[model samples]
Structure formats: C-alpha cells, structure tokens
Target: MKYMSICIISFFNLIFFSISLFIMSLYFIMNEYVIFLEWEVVSLNSLSIVMTFLFDWMSLMFMSFVLLISSLVIYYSKEYMSGDLNINRFIMLVLMFVLSMMLLIISPNLISILLGWDGLGLISYCLVIYFNNVKSYNAGMLTALMNRIGDVALLLAIAWMLNYGSWNYYYYLDYMKNDNNMMLIGGLVMLAAMTKSAQIPFSSWLPAAMAAPTPVSALVHSSTLVTAGIYLLIRFNLLLVNTWMSQLLLLISGLTMFMSGLGANFEFDLKKIIALSTLSQLGLMMMILSMGYYKLAFFHLLTHALFKALLFMCAGMIIHNMNNFQDLRLMGGLSIYMPLTSSCFNIANLALCGMPFLAGFYSKDLILEIASLSVLNMFIYYLFYFSTGLTVCYSFRLVYYSMTGELNCSSLNVLNNEGWIMLKGMLGLMFMSIIGGSMLSWLIFLTPPMICLPSLMKFMTLLVCVIGGLIGYFISKISLFFINKSLNNYMTSLFVGSMWFMPYISTYGLINYSLKIGMNTFKNFDQGWIEFIGSQNLYNKLVNFSKFNNVVMNNNLKIYLLIFILWIMILMMFLMFL
Candidate 1:
C-alpha cells in the first residue's frame, strides 16, 4: 500500500511537470529560442570538461512526451505490479529509466549523452529482469548485449571526437562533414543509433524484450528505450545529408520497417506483436531521418509514442484479465466484454495504421507523401509504401484475433475492464492518440509539407492501407484447408514470420560461432599447449631444478662445500691473472 501510494503520488507530480514542459516547449518552438547552459566541471590544459544542457524546442518537446508517457506508465504500473513485494524497487527503476532519458535528451555533449545513454541501457536491463525468471533473465541479457553494441559505438565516437578537443559533437557536426577523418564520426554515430534502434541484425532483442512486465513494455517500447536511438538520429540527421552512407541507412531503415511489419503479422503473442509494431514505427522514423527529414521523424516519434503507449496499455489490460496469457490465438471477442479497452485498443491500432484525423496520419502520411516527391529510385519508393501497407496488415490482423474473433478461453475465467487506475492511464493516452498528431503537427511545422504528386501516387497510401486491412482480416481467418496447404511454404512463413530468422541470427546465430571459436581457443591454447609451455611447463622445470639442487646441498653437504671452494679458487685465480 505504501509503495502503491508512492507511485500514484509520483504519477500526478510527473504529469503536472510534463504538461508544464509541453507549454514551455511550445513557447520555445514559436520564438525559436534555444536556451543553452553549460557548467565547467573541470579544466585540464586546453581541454575544459563542460556539462551542457540544450533546451531547444525539439528537445523540450520530445522530453515532454517522454515524461508524459513515463508518468502514465508509472500510474499504470501501480496496478500492473500491485501484487508484487518489490513494487518500490520497480518504481525506483522506472523513475531511474525516465531520468536517464531526460539526461540523454537535455545534453549536447557526447560524454554526457553517453552517461545518459549507458544509464538507459543499464536501467533497462534491470527493468527487463524485474520479473526475475529465466525468460526475463535471458531477455535482459539479450537486451543488454545488443544495446552494448551501440554503447561501444558511441564510446568510439567520443574517442574519435577527442581529436576535435571537446566531446560536443553538436557544435562540430557541420565541420565534421568536410574533414574525412572527422566524417568517420557520423558513421560511428549512425552505427550507434542503428544498434540502439534495433535495426536488422540487431532486431531480435526488441521482440524478445517482451519478457519484461507489461508496464515496462509500455514505457520502453513507446517513448524511452527504442525511441532513444531515433531521437539521437534526429539530433544528428544533418550528417546524413552530405555523407555517402545516407543511402545505406535509408535501405537499412526501410528493411527494418518492412521486416518488423512482416514479423508482426506472423506473431501470435500479444505483447510481441505490439513490440514488433514499435520496431516498425522506429524503422519509419529512421527511414525519413536518413532522408534528412529530422523534424518529420521527430514528429512521427512523438506521435508514435502516444498511440503505441496506449496500445501497450490496452494490451496489458487484456493480458491482465486473461490470466497473463498473451497468445492472441486464444484471445477473442474482447471488445464485447471490455468495451473501453477494446475502444482504446482499436483507436490506437487505427492510429498505427495511420488512419485519417488521427495522430499517426499527421506524421506518417506526410512522411510517405514527402518521400514520394523525392527523386528516388522506384525500389526505394515502393519500399516506403509497401512497408506502410504491411503496417496496416499486421494491425488489422491483431484486431481480428483479439477484438472481433471468437472468444477462445478456458472455463471459469472472468474478463472485465475493472481497474480504474489502469483505465485512467489508457484514457490519457487515448485522448492524445486522437489529438496528439494534429497538436504536434501544428507546433512542429510552421508551414505544411507540400508534395505535388500525381493523384494515383497521392491516394496510393490509402489504397494500400485499405487493401492491406482486408488482407490482414482474411489472413487472421485462415481456413484449415489453407493451413494444410501452407505446409509446403511453412519454411517461407517461418523465415518471414521469424523476422527472417533474425531472432536466431541475433541469438544462436550470433552466439554459436563466437562460443565455438572461444571453446576451440580454450582447447588449443589456454587449456592446451599454452598451459603446458607457459605456466605448467615452467613450474615443472623450476621444481625439478630446485629438487636437483636440494639433493646436492642437503644429501651431499661436502660436495656443496667443495663446489663453493672450487668456485672461490677459480674466482681468486682469475682476479690474480687480471
């Protein structure tokens, strides 16, 4: 009860602060006022250690949404972890997680960014393992290891930036583009962001991290952990314009978007499906970001946070009532029983599908429209639209299985939307999911994004979305005959559905070869010839020589004395001759 009250009180405080920050951000955005404050922590020779805080409209705005979602996640967790003994610990970890994100957002210094960056990774690992089970442990390990790749990349970027004398990459980002030696920093930064965002081979950890408690999922997936990378990219997006690597980033982000969308369609687990959608949205942000539309990406990022948080909260409510069962195959007709949850879930889901007048439409539609207007190849253009379609496909698939389908539950199970606290949490995001898009759209863009495109190209997004929805609905109702027929292409579905074996590639695919080589190294070197020739062989020879000397000295003292006398005589004779 004490812990519960703490979270409840904290939630109210955070929400108040979040609202204040949002208002401040609007003022900052309108006036174009950037408040940069720096404190000199220390100075060594010419190098001054300064901690910098950047309160621009972008950072302020992004941090506002982050705090808003975090506040609700805290409020939601009160009931989510109500029965747990360590709700206090969970609250601490969640707050720590939010603080780390705040640090990352406000700092322009690479060193400070990394401090916050590493804090995020560390706190996330703690949260992932909060359930303290083998699944959580494994998931946490994967999450930590995967994020460590980004941490190392960011560390390397910091080291490379040392040549520039200060770790403030923001100050030097423009200068970095011209110097070949310095341009490497952009690639390093890009690599770091990609790893953090869980692109391609790094993608497996995002889904597996669903082993975390649902409230953690709501926070991590929506606004904090995954978005951290996208936010960083938004900060450095200008580098993508002049660098040759931007094309590669575009391709990678597109593939990540498409891959995650496909994976979500095939996923059965409720949380994992939402997790995949988060990944898909991340990829979308990165895609536009690589194209140098940082503001659009940021816009999408903020909007995505609102709806995705609501989506996860709704999914949590469902899972909570379903006795922790997350398989959508077993969840059906949830709308009939839990009307409020179903309504929120469907609205968030539709927003995810980029439905008109919703938060997603304002950003997502603009991104695709702008991308369509760009002078890009047909392949890249198709990648953007096709990935959008897949987003709708998987979203409607979820609706079919969870909302409108037959209720597949065990006897004696009772499902209702009874938790007022959790419901309140979802309601805040639900209202935002409806209006957050236009709200952010108005604030972020002084002028609307204009794209003079053919009508077919303009309407293409809606057309694809509709067709994709129909396909997704029918796909969810797969007939037994089709299931039998798909046995032939089971391998294909397995490949695509399993994120193209990305989970395997990320987990077993990554670990097996490394572990195999390590074992071989141990067998052939550390435990084998090196052990014999290095320490063991040296020890054996030293012991044998010591024993030989001991036998002569102890067993034959006369011989020892005679040798000493002979050595002295020889030394005396040699000295006399000299």
Candidate 2:
C-alpha cells in the first residue's frame, strides 16, 4: 500500500514534468521569456521583503528534468528498498528532497535560495544516516559539516549583497557585474558552489555520501545536490566571466577532473567508482562554466543527469543481487546472470565515455572541441584531453572488472532479472540516455556549436578513447607481481588507492587536530585558569571575608564594655573642667 502511494506520487510528478517541459518549450520558442512572480510579504519604513519565483527556460527545463529523474528514482526505490521497515519514511524524505530542489530551481533571491540550499544539506544528512549504523553516522556527519561550510559561505554572500540593498540577486547580477565587492560575492558563491559540487578539499564527502541508499545516491549525486552548485555558478556566470576567480576556478576544476579520474581508477568500491565519476563530470561542468561556456556547461549538466542517475541505479541493482557486496573485485561474470542489467550498465558507461550519438557525446564532445579551440596554455589544454582519456580508461576498467572477467566471488551468484519494477525505472532513463543529449541540444541551444578544427584535433577524442580502452583492457589483465614485490608498493598503493589521502586529511588530519586544540583549550582555560580565577578563587575570597566578619562579631561584647567605661571617665573629666 505504501509502495502504491509512492508510485502514485511518482506518476503525478511525471505528468507535471511533461507539462512543465511543454510550457518551457513553448516559452522558449515564443521568446517571451522570464516570468517573475512575486508577492509582497513584509514592509519596513523603506524596505520590503517579497517572495519571488523566477521562471525561464533554464529554471523550468531544469526543474522538469529534476522531477523526471526524481520520479524515476522513486519508482526505482520501491523495489530496491522494499524490504526496509521504514520505506514510508524514506519515501517522504525523497519527496522532501524533490521539493527542496524545486524551491532552489525557481528562486532568484539569495534568501529564498538558502531555504533550498539548507534543505538539501539537512535532508541529505538524514538520508545518509538512514541506515542507523556507525559508518552511516560518520559519513552523514562528514557530508553535513562539509556542506555546512558552503552554507556559511553563501550566507556571507548574502550579507555582502546587502550592500546592494536587496536579496534579489537576479537584479544585481548584471548591475553589480564589474564591482569589486561583487567580485567578493562571486568568490563566496564560488566557494559555496565548490563545496557543494565536491571540488578539491571538499571532494571527500561525495564518495562518503554513497553510504546513503543508492536511490538517494542516484538523485543526489546526479541531478539534485551536486548539480545545485553547478547550476548556481551557471546562473551567476555573467558576473564570473573573465574574473581572476573564474580563472582560478578553471584551474581548480581541471585539477578536480584529473584527480577524480585518477581516484576512480584506483577505487575498488563499485558505487564509489560511479560517485567519483560523477565528481569528475561535475569538474568538467565547472571547468567549462569557468571558461565562460555557460550554456554548454548547463547543457552538459542536464545530459549528465540522465546517464549518471541510470548508472547509479544499475550499480544498485548489481549490489542488490550481490547481497550488498559492492566491491568490483568480487563482482565478475555478472553479465552472464544479469544480462539486461549489464546491458543497461554498459550503455550508461558508454554514454559516460562520451561515445558518439549517446547522451554524453553531444555536450562532452562540444566542450572538448571548444576547449581545444580556446586560447589556453599547454597545461590546461593537455589536462582537459588527458582527463577525457582517463574517463574512458577508468570506465573500461570498471566494465572489464565487473562484466567481462572471471567469476571472482567466493560463492556462487544467482543474479536474476526479476526486479521488474526497478527495471521499469531504468528503462525510462535508458531511453533518455540514448536520446537526451540530442533532444536537449536542440531545445537548449538556438544553434549547434560551430566547430572548426584540424582533423587531428577533431579525432583526438576518438584516439584517446581507443588508447584508453586498450590500456584499460591490458592493465586489468596484467598481474601486479613486480609492483607488489617492490619496497615502495605500500606507499604508492596507499596514496593512489585512498583517494590521495583525502579521506585521511578530511577526517583524521582535520578532525584530530581540531579536537586536539579543543582539548587543550578545555584543560588550560575552562578547567584551569577560569576555574582558578573565576570560580574557585572567588569562592575562597568570599569564605575568608565571612570568617573575618564572624571573628569580629564574636569580640563585640568585650569591646562594648570597654567603650562604656571610657565614656563615663570622659564625662567626669568634662564636668571637672567646667
């Protein structure tokens, strides 16, 4: 019964998705764009607080896609989490996430955006800790606190924006585009976006967030939470273009793509591999956006959502059949047992590799073509294409390990294609993965991206694809005996395999040092100096003063008798003098 209700909600959302998409398309074609719906809520002497919703092709199309993916995830979860005792609560949280994302999509006001931003963080934490285990709790805390840093950054941006006298950032993005203060605002927004999108120092929480149910992983990593940052930057791209911050962003995002790709290659957890891939794609989006290709970045963002969500769902199915085992080393010969799921996985993986005519192809290829044509230095240029190759390299490695290799598990696996409900959910995305890029390219862009490059430059993607495939294939098959026997194996393997020590730096390095400082402060200040000077010393002084007063009072009777005798003698002397 709870399942049916969730399905009904999903079906309802699908209708809304279709209608919203249609309206967005019509609005785009008519070119009568940008509807602002506002209602005054409060008024001060000269200030007004109003509720505002911005409707345009960007927001509408994005919201529609979010709803579509969310609905599918809801449907998918029905099967994936059917055995959970708290499925109803889980569905409610998912619904809340959808609502929060929608609020974020429509709001042009910074204050309103906070509602959504914070909702995403809080709800994501709840989702991450839903399993009520130690790992879940730790991962949830890490995810929440890491995101909270971004939340704080955004609040700072909002405070800085008060210099403009309003929270409506849409109005100020253009007006304050060139102001230095605006640069600060943009910087803060970028910091916020970076944390949310898992760039650099903030990237660890993303893979850790995989502790959540795979449905949440699908929705959060793919379209909702991670994309929130990219989407924010896309909205603010006008202010960011040509700024030093944007250049800095380009550098950081490029490195992120490279690092995440390298990390994915070294990762063994199946879901973590996919999560790292999502991180790499996010970096790609941010990199392009930093280069001022806002439309292309947004286009890729939408296309990525389709294939990535499907990829996570595919991973979920495999994990489910494996009885919660998510290690790629233990997952082999899965294709023989679960052909349909494997096919879906392969298709998603290919799309992720940016194969021609697939969803990732249209946007990714255009971005590459644009990157190649840009007036960039050799470092950025090489990083861009090399990361592209790394993407395919890790992808093929993942494919070979899980699908084409020997059955490496310790026990016999009976993988079945019986999750009809989950399969149904995947089918929708599969169709989208095949056609979403082309469809989005047509609707989002007025003209196809013009590419004029040498044949070698044009074929660079294909060349890398081939090279990566061969390398991945051979590397997967090769024995690591020589490397294992080397003295440096532990150090080298630890660095690469542990995401370059990010988990350690984020958790132990940062947390331990902070705790150490806190303990020192507690022992020396709160328990030592403050106790001596403020509490213990003051109490001792009061006790000593009371004891002195008591002794003086006890001697009062003797003092009074002596005073009476002295007064009588003084009166007699005065009479004799008179």
Candidate 3:
C-alpha cells in the first residue's frame, strides 16, 4: 500500500503540474515573453558559476509534454511493475528521470545542462539493468558507454567554452560561431547530440535498451532521453546552419533513417520493431534539424513522442496479455481478442507511418515537402522519400504480423483488453497522439509554412506510402522471403536484421578487436621490451656484478699478497733509481 502511494501521489501531482505548465506556456507564447533567471552559485578570481533557467514558450511546452508522458508512464508502471518487490525503487527512479529531463528542458547554462545530461545517462543505466539479468546488464553497459562518448564530447565543449568566461551557451551562440575555437565547440556539441540521439555510428544502444521495463521505454527512450540531443541542437541551431558539420549531419541522419527502417522490416522482436521506428523518427528529426528546420524538428519531436509513447504502451499491454512473449512471429490474430488495445496499436502504428490527418501526417508530410524544395542533391532527396517509404513498409509489416494472422500464442493464453489500470495510462497519450500534432502545429508555427511544388512532386509522399504499404503487405506473404531465398539469405538477413551489424560493431565487435590488440601489445611490448630490458635484464646484470664482487671479496688473501708484491717491486725500482 505504501509503495502504491508513491505511484499515486507522484502521478497526480505530475498531472497537475503538467497541466499548469501547458496553460503557462500558452500565456507565455501569447505574450511573446522569454525569461532568464540566473543565480550566482560561486565566484572565485574572475571565474563565476551561475545556474541559469530559460522560460519560454518552447521550453515550457516541451516540459509540459515531458511531465505529461512521465506521469502517465508512472501511473502505468503501477500495474506493469506490480509483481516486483522493488516497485517503490522503480517509481523513485522514474521520478528522478523526469526531474532530470525537466532540468535539461529549462537550463541554458552548460554546467546545469551537463548535470541533467549525466543524470539521464546514469539513471537510464540504472533503469535498463533493473531486471537484474545478464542481457539487461549488457544493454546497460552498451547504453552507458555509447553515451559516454557524447558526454566526453560535451565536457570538451564545456572546457572550450571557458574562453568566454561563462558556461552559458546562449550569450555566445549568435556571434561566436565564427571563431575557430567556437567552431570546434560547435562540432563537439553536434557530436554530443548525435551520440545522445543515437544517430549513425552510435545507434546500437536504443533497441538494446529495450531490456528495460516498457514503462521506461514509454517515458525515457521514446520521449525524453533520445530527444535531449535534438533539443540541445535546436537551441544551437544557429551555429549549425550552412556549416560542413550540418552537411555531414544531414548525410548521417539520412543513412540512419534508411538503416533503421530497413532493419525494422527484417526484425521479429515486437519491441525492437517499435524501437527501430523510434530510431527512424529520430533520424527524421535530426535530418530536418540539420537542414536548419529546428521548429519542424521540435514539432515532430512532440508529436512523435505522443504517438510513440502510446505505441510502446499498447505493445506493453499486448506483451503482458501474451505472458511476456515479444517475438512478432509468436503474436498473431490478437486484434480479434483485444479490440481496444489492438485499435490503439493500429492507430499508433498508422500514425507512425504518417497516415492521413493523423498526428504524424501534419509534421512528417510537411518536413518532406520542405525538404524536397531545398537545394539538395538527388541522393539526399532519395534518402528522404525512400526512408519515408521504408518507414511505412516496416510499420505495416509489424501491424500485419502482430494483428492479422492465426493466433500464435500458447493454448492456455487468454487475450483481453481488460487491464483498466494500464489502459488508463495509455488513454491520456492516445488522445494526444490524435490531436497533439494539429494543436502543436497551430501553436508552434504562427504562420504555416507555405509549400509549393508540382502535382507529382506534391503526390510523392502519398505515392511512397501507398507503394510501401502494398510492398509491406505482399512481402510478408512471400514464400520466397520466408523460405530464406536470396534476400533472406543468412548473410543478407544478418546484415539488415541486425541493424547492419551495428550492435555487433558498436559493442562486442569493437571490444573484441580492442582486446585482441591489447593482447598483442602485451606480447610485443610489455612482455617483449619491458621484460627483456627492464626486470629480466636488470636481474642478469645484477647477477654478473654480484658474482664479480663475490670473487674479489672472498679472495681477500690473494688480493693482499698481490698488493704487497706490487709495493715491493715499486720499492726495488725506487732503490735502483736512487
């Protein structure tokens, strides 16, 4: 009862606070007000540390969404985590995660931002390994180490920012980008964002992190932790525009988008499928953000968060009803039994694919149109629309496999949508996923973006979705693919299904190679050079020196006789000379 109280109190309080923040954001936006509150924490010999908070429409709105999702997640966790003895600890960890995200949302100072950033990494590691299994531990280690790269990059950025005598990035963001040192800082910040967001070269951690509870996935991975990097880049958007770094980011994000979408199509793990979709959406956000469309990125961020959170929650319910099985092949014809949950699942999946007038449509379609009009190359354009099609492809494939085929669960399993406790938490985000996009668009963009293109060009988004959906449906039925034909061969499936072997590369592949290199170094250097020239060589030399000394000392009588004979000979020589 006491443990449940923690969940109840935190959930209700957060709901109230989130609603309050939403109203405040509306007022703040209408007034066109941005407030900066700073408190000087310490002053020492020309160095000052100040904690800074930024309150504006953007920050307030994001914070409101975060708290909203987090509260619902907590409410949902009450049922999802009820069996665990450490439910209280889980609730507290979640609360701490929300607080850290809030800190990240409002802070303008790099020092405070680092606190929030590190808090996310640390707390996420705790949450990921909460199940106390080797799989969870491995996932946590991978998640933490991959993020640590970004942490180091950000720390370097902080150190370089010392030249301006302040850790506040806003004061110098506008003008200092041209300075060489500041450019370096911008690069570091972008790298940090890339790692945190799980962009290409660092994307192996997101799906791996599904070892955590589904509630954590709903709150942290889907909504908060992954997006922290994008939000930071949005704040630093001015520095990234028209730079080589942004150009590079655009390419990398586009590839990540393609890679994730392709990977999801070949995956069977239900949670990993959604996780890959999250990764694909992140790539979309990063792609647009890199193109200087920060507003669109943030808009998509909010909208994607709503639906993606719901998607995870619905998946959680299904997984729960199935008695913890997550394999897509092991789940079939579930829509027949769990109507409400299936509807939510289908709607969220459709939203992810940018179904017409849904939440994703408003943001994703607009991003593609704007991207098409940009002065970019055909390769970049292909990446955008092709990734969009792949998104639809994988999403449709997931829904079909999970909801339409013969029942694949165990004979004893009885599926139903009767978990009112879990449904209540999902219901909040479910409605938001439907309307959050339109409302956010109207609120965030004062003047809607004017997009003009030819008819076929305009139809490109719909065209791809249709084609991809058809392919997704037909491909799943293909005996050729299921029978391990050309495209389904061991090598090809292994490559695409494993996120292009990113998990292996980012985790054990690199690690294994590194350990081998260290072993070789030990054989070549430590054992070879140091052993020969250092201790062993010193022992040999000392042995020889000791032997010579021992001979001279032990034969002291002979030495004295030799000395006497020499002395007499000298005397005789002296007499002869006289």
Candidate 4:
C-alpha cells in the first residue's frame, strides 16, 4: 500500500515537471514575438499564439527556482502528510498552487495575469487553512481580506487601462509615450505591489499566515506568494525605470525592511520569526528592484528561497522532534539529540545570516553595493545597511535560542533523520544555499565588480554576523527580559495606536461623524413633526375623514355638496382677484 501511494505521488510530480519544462521551452522559443509584433513586421491579429516571452535571464532564473522549490514541497508533503484523511485533497491543492504560480510567472497580459494572481492567493488561503482548525481559519480569512485590498488596486489599474482602450501589457508599453499617463499607471502599479508584498500596514496578514503547517509556510510564505509582488515589479521594469513611482517604491520598501527586521527580533514562535524575516528580506528585494538592479534582486530572491525554505523545514523537524512544541523556550539542547537536523539548521541559519562563501553573502552584498552608489539618496542607503544588520541579528537569534542553549527539558523520542526523502529535500535546498550565487552569476548578467574592498566588505559582513549572534546569545542567556517583550510592545502599539488612528486619517471619519449627526436630526424630526402627526392619530384620522366623505357622497347629497364646494372656492378666488 505504501509503495502504491509513493508511485501515485511520483506520477503527479512527473506531470508537473513535464508541464514546467514545456512552458519554459515555449517561452524561450517565442522570445522575439513581442518585438516582431511591436515593429509591425508581423500582424498582431494574425498571430495564433499571443506570445509575450518573459524569457529574460532574470525571469528564467526565478522561474527555475520556483519550480525547484515547488517540487521539493510536493516531495516533502508525500511523507509529511502521509496518513491524513484528506491527503488526496492536500495533494490536489498543492498541484493547483503550483499551476497558478506558473501561470502568474508566464502571464503576459494584465488581465490574464490577474487570473493567476487571484488564483494563487485563493490556493494559498486554502493551503493555510487546510487543517481547518479555528486558528487556521482565522489566518486564512485575514490573508484573504488583506490580499483583497491589493487585488482591488490591481483590478482598478487594469480597469483604468482597459477603459482607455489598452487591454494588454504591450499596449501599456506603447502608452508610456505619454509621460503623464505613464506616471499614473506607475503609481497604481506600485500601490498594488506594495499591498501584495505586505509592506507596512499590509504586512500584518503575513505573520498571521504562519498558522499553516510548516511545509505550507515554507513553500507559500517563504518561496512563492510574497515573491509575487517583486516579480510583478521586475516584470514591468520599463514602466518603473524613470518615474516618481520608483521613489515611492524605495520609501515603502525601506520602511518594511526596517520594521519587519525589528519585528523578527521580538517574535517567540519559531514560524512567526521566520515569517517576519521573510518579510524583511522581501523588503530588501523590493528596495533593490526600485534601484533598477533587476539582476541583484533576482539573485537575492533565488538565495532567499533556498535558505528560507530550509530554515522553515528545519523548524518543522524541530517541532516534530519535540512532539509539536513550537516555542523555542521549551526547546533547548536539541543539537545532541538530533545532530543531523541541528547541523542542517545551523547551515541554513548561517546562510541566512549572510556568512561569507554562502549564497546570501554574494546576493546581499550586491544589493548593498547598489544601494551605496551615489545615485540613491544617502538616507535610503543607510536604511538598507541598518536593515542588513538587523537581518543578521534575527537570523542568528533563531539559531542560538533553538539549538545551542543549555538542556532544559528531558529529550523526547527523536525520529531518525526521517530517511532520505526529507533529508534529501533539505540537502538539495542546502546545496542551493551554498552555490546559488555562483549559479546565479552564470545565469544572469551580474559580474562581480572589480572593487578593491569586495573582500573587505565580505569580511565585515561576517564580523557583523558573529557579533550579532554573540549579542543575541548573551541576551537570551543572561537577561531577565521577557523573550518576546519587544514584539508584544510593537504589536500593541500597532493595533492600539496606528490601527485606531486610521479612521481619523481617512475620509471615513468625517462620513461617520456626518452619519451620527444625520441620525440625531432624524431623531429630532421624529420628536417634533412626527410626534405632532402621531398626536393627531394621522392614520386613524385619515380613515375617519374618508368615512365622513363617503357618507356625504351618498346619492344626491354628494352632487349638492360638490357643487356647493366648487361655488365657494370660485367666489373666494374672485374676491381675492378683485
């Protein structure tokens, strides 16, 4: 039975792999379809396939990473979700998520793109809430609601473009001839991207989304969903290249980076901390995108997927080892019991912390170099640098608190490294974490700049990692401070202050106040005019008046009375005129 189940799962994976390869090849073959259509050498209407080849090196690299991560998620799920009653349902959802994400990556038109965009969001919500518990339901609901805001913006932008007779991405490219319209579209696109990416106010849903299983969190949160925003911006790079919208992107991205980094510092739940770190890393990618460093942003995205997925999976192993205990406080001295798990966890953490010779080091350093260039504002560069330091602090804290501290509780039955299936997945991802940068360098146009201090900068980054880890270790070891004090304070301030203040800042405040006043005026009317009418027994009086009129209208009496009333009215009007 187990062997049969494995074969069925393998069959599904084979189908997915085949589809991915076919789409990738088709995208490459149709690379010049856009150019040919644009130059009018080929009639657009005559073309059977509406081919907009998103086959640039950066996009191809990202797509490859997406496919690789998604395949691992499926493989991991085969074992992870082995005996659940709804295992078939889970596999179906996983397949759908992969399909939607692929559609999103290759979509050439804004309208078609939204099909995949909304589809992925829906699938993710389903995946997150797959356990169907109350907490998971709440998390799914929050994700659905928050992403709706982004979807609305995206829909509006698409509507606005379509209303102006632009139905496709190519039309928008041509429409950019008008600088004003270009700026408007750019602003709307950035708004959509910001919300989808969970920048600032939109970021709340992401951490809440951690109620999902570790694999779901690993794939959706770390590898795919959040990266969608960065992908959109990069996909439409020409629109953002020289516009005020680019500045807005930089500002929002910078704030998200700093704030999420700080948030990561305070989170106690292992998954929640990783979620925040994902947010911060996404912010850095956005910041890099805004700087027009597509290659660097793509590189970072690749490296991030590798290490973040590994981290979450390692966290999963830890949780599983401890019999589903997610709190790091209760998880101490796990290294001795689960050496293989701890080793993989440490390697992933080191990569995440941007240790030298790791994937993160090269990609992050490239972003920092671009940020430091004189073209960007000084404040922006410093903000990026500060966020980088914070990244180190949180990444290592996750490592120290969970793995290396003194043994506090008796060890539970630790599962054997769960054989080759799970570990193979982790090891495959770990290999990418180590060599992703070198692979990316060959895939993309990025060449290491011939700067004298490249080595020095690498050393400094490592030093920061070491120092940051030490600080986190000491704080965790000696301080009487509560573990999640910083996070609690931050969330409290956000909910109590900012969320409350939103009503006052928006036009809704005036509208709500006006509604209250209007209701009071209606109340006054009811007390005065309506009360007078009620005192007269208006409905009853009307019935009585009709009864009296009916009696008077009886037979000849009705005719006499009508004549008399008409004469009296005529006499009065005549007298007034005279």
Q: Considering every candidate listed, which one attains the maximal TM-score?
A: 3
lDDT tens digits by residue: candidate 2, 1-578? 85667666765776577577767756865695778999889999998888999888888888888888988898898888889878888989998998999899899999999999999999999999999999999999999999999999999999998999888888988877998888899999999999999999799999999999999999998899999999999989997788899899999999889989877776778999999999899999999999999999999999999999999999999999998899887888888989999999999999999999999999999999999899999998988988888899889989988998677776767779999999999999999999999988888778776889999999998898889878877766662344335523464467865667888998999889989999999999889989899988999999999998898799989878989999999999999999
Q: TM-score for all predictions? A: 0.89, 0.88, 0.90, 0.78
Candidate 3: residue pairs that collide: none
Each prediction's RMSD over C-alphas, in Å, is 6.7, 5.7, 5.0, 7.6
Q: What's the lDDT of the predicted structure labeled candidate 1?
A: 0.88
Give each model's whole-structure lDDT. 0.88, 0.89, 0.91, 0.72
Compose the digit string of candidate 4's lDDT tens values, residues 99-170: 777777766567667888899889889988988899989778878877888788788778767655644665
- Tell me the tens digit of each residue's lDDT in model 3 across 88-130: 9999999899899999989988889999999999999999999
Ranking by lDDT: 3, 2, 1, 4
- Name model 1 segments beyond 4 Å from true: 42-48, 479-481, 484-489, 514-578
Output the TM-score of candidate 2.
0.88
lDDT for position 79 in model 1:
87
Error of 4 at 266 (Å): 1.1
On a 0 to 1 TM-score scale, where does candidate 1 land against the true structure? 0.89
Leading candidate by lDDT: 3
Give the lDDT of residue 77 in candidate 2.
89
Those runs of model 3 whose alpha carbons end farther than 4 Å from true positions after fitting are 42-48, 479-486, 489-493, 517-578
